[model samples]
Target: MGASFCSPVDERCTCSLQSTIHAFRFPLWAVKVSDFLEMLGPPRPHHRLQEEGLLHEWFPGMFVIFTSHQWLSSTHPDPQGQQMEVLQKALRGMIDGSLQVHEDLVARSDRMNLSNTIRQHIAEGFLFFDWFAIPQITVRKDGVNEESVKSAAALAVQSIPAYVELSNVFIALVPELTHKDSSALVNYASWLSRGWCRAELWCRLLSNKIDTTVIVIHSPTQAEFMFPLDWQHNSIVNGNFTVESDRAIVVQLGETAVESKIQHLQVHGPLRDCRFYCALRPKLLCQERADRTLQKFLEDFRFGSLEQAVKDTSGMNAVMCAILSGDTGMLRLLAESRADVSRPMHGLNDLGYYDTQTPLMAATKSHQDPAVLTTLVELRADPNGRASNTKLSSLYMCRSAGHVRALLEQRAELEHAALHGAAALAGPDTLRELLSRQCDPNHILAGRQERFGPLHAVALFSLSNRHAVEAAKLLLEHRADVNSRSSPSDEFLWECRKARMRVVVLGFANCNMMTRLRASMSGISPLGYAALVGHGQLTQLFLDYGADPTPNDRGDTPEDLARRNHHYHLIPMLATFAT
Candidate 1:
């Protein structure tokens, strides 16, 4: 296949652990992967990374990355009182039993009692592997300190044979995973093919970066997603992750090297012709394509395309690498084999597809997957296929989603895709499945970039608010119009302030890492976008939820928009919630 693909896209071939006692056998050397996943910070009052607004998620581009500095932390060579007397003599060799239960105990207790304070001081801390919930199917029920899961299971039995040689090169290149969450999809390649949980409870959950995210079985047609591949599989619309091209990988059990793991493997299909695919990269053309072999190149094109009129200038053209990997089955096998399916194959230094599309508008990208937009509308592909939001099409992105009405009820015509909004971007099931097919959850979008209106489309937004308050209580039980029939009125927080600074600098933006509440800018509400952005306790949990101190005809109020935006670090908690 492309000359039997032999590694070497070189970030120094990913390995490093001069003293690997067990941080997952310390590898995947240059470690910096975050096309959005930076939440691991709270172990015991360790806050200062600019106090981490921290509510994060989305890694649907399923990943694997490795690197470790190991952690003897009290400054080594018997320093903090001889490393607390060698962790109190390894907790008397774990209370006189002699510690074994290996399989990479967080890479096998990197040289004992995992830095013991008699098992990290137990008020309810210790057990590991809790990155975004779903591994052996739910841990952290609070119970793992067997001397910190044994020193990361002797560094995960030397990092599970380097992820079984990188899941044998992504299970011989994406054959479509094989079938339904294939055992929670590779469960980190079945936690290193059934050796499961060692490196002492995977370093007591990656040394307290105790994060979350796992989709499984990453390659034979891609799926290995550690965290955030965009979730909400059934209710409240959007970010579905379309499984079933046999199985699509979600791989990442432990680690060894190759830049600590992640080789670009998403591959969706249908919702009018979904896209994504860049499997096995490293051809190196270099003009300043940012290079470490190009980081997340728009999630695997990494940094090499700001000009694609439908890529594949040379090799590996699985439907032009699946429309440069927006990949809805190689973009419907290259638009059912025609392949130009509206040609905007690359151009995203910051959005520029500029053209028409039919492959279900190239898989509906401000984030997609309701069974790959219902298999690109049963392969006819075009549930109102037009682009740049002329009025509204992708059925307002399947009306805030119920699995895109469980796949547009299996073959299109779910009343203009449930009344259009995927472009202005909002879906609690594509707008309550377009007001349950009557099409008027206050139906706005007269022309271009239409962001919000029904008194800012109701909610109890993301970080788990329960599906935009259950699709705004089913569009206020179908009466719809929360306001804005063409507002001279405009005061529901100014429409939440014109979408609230992209939701206070991209907040509820996750998938697979699973977060959903999104829409904003009417003002003074989401407690003035969390006190205009200081988040004082998520602006006191959005003023317990009433959120309206007044001053609209534009005089400015959530404490004068937090003192005219200086946010003097959240103006003494927005002047104690404006008295």
Candidate 2:
């Protein structure tokens, strides 16, 4: 509606909030950033700053004294440098406390990452586990091969140049990187990025392309993939063509190459399984729900219904479940009821699964009541039955120091069976004993990507920052492959990042860790990972071992990731190279 000389009262007046007008004007001093943005008057202060004697009365005007006690950075608030922190604190208070919604303005800004700025100050809130700080390998107590190991390690490290060319060779193949060598990769890319896009000249991640995939089925438990037939020859996300899935988000690279060499490849021409290891009809999809079925059986000594369980005497799983549960009465009843005490499990994809052993294998995984295990043994259950499908029998399940003395038993080597992947899941002590018994370290049982032996299994299992130190120690004493390319994904780095674990500072000739370094996508080794997540000592260790401060295709290196991830303590680590 228009009004010309009041022809018609303008309807525009009915709408509220014009900046030039005010029913009751107020000073801006009492207003908050939020209230001003809303274009609405704030609620009256409980007590005006002047009324509360909180402000100094100047000749004509007065103002509130912004004390540092109320705001840590009040005296030196660097708005540009600390905007993220300020916004995060304010947002948090608004969400959790008294601040009212600043709807119109709040919806416009993105400040989630700003919160990470403050988290940078805290320590130890984020470690997934503490086992990462410990060493993974150890020396054999018996000293059986000490001299041989020393000779091998010294020969390997001394033969290789200190500053090896990363682009030209498979560092993992060097004898210096053999099992006895003690070096590992440390990744810390997040700290290096510090949350900003890198300069273009340093090499931006233009894009990553993958148009090929190969699938292979392995029973009901797992599956495999091959990007190129020549796995040994390739490395990178889609690099030399073979590997299996680890977790959902692994940052893997096969090898390092400048932009030019990456463009040319021989396998651009050809391509290559089925059944979802699933509810997916394959073994993996809806696999055992949290190991609950096993957990329950181990706890209850019986299934949901004891009656149904008692009738199946030869059911190896039922016996094993009873033993794992350590229910002496249940075992007594089962054995008295004529259960086949000598039967073993049938699902031996490897020694880890469907292992044969009527109920003996069950007891191995369970630390149940000793009486139940003894009862099963007294009932003539085979201590050395042919296991599910492994190289050794059921006796090796008692690898624990306690279990070993209890059973005086048992063990495998099908390095590359279809169950080869599962074989990688074997226990460290169990494998160590087997290797001590002279099992071939490089034996390929069924289908294995890397023919390296038991040590690879130990290192891979320690990925979660759990059992890594002990696992590594056992492998080292036995001479596990330091540079061996294990399961192909870059998962080791992720676990390192999560825990900020530090690897040993073994010399470079022993840099079997180079493959692990190259396999990771971001410019981080496990040490870099630790630094980004705020582990200073880990950063030092990796630097000593020569963790390169190189960035990936994105020009975001370990130092960059650490800062961005709010691992402020690690920022100074890079200063060592700051000439």
lDDT of 2 at 426: 37
Each model's TM-score?
0.26, 0.31
In candidate 2, position 123 carries an lDDT of: 14
Question: What is the per-residue lDDT of model 2 for residues 151-206, given as tens digits with 9 covering 90 to 100?
Answer: 54344222111101100100010000001122222211111121110111011111
Scored by Cα lDDT, where does model 2 land? Answer: 0.31
TM-score of model 1 (CA atoms): 0.26
Off by over 4 Å in 2: 1-308, 312-321, 328-333, 340-358, 369-399, 404-455, 463-465, 487-579
Q: Against the unseen true structure, what C-alpha lDDT does each candidate score? A: 0.31, 0.31
* Residue 543 miss distance in model 1 (angstroms): 13
lDDT of 1 at 25: 55
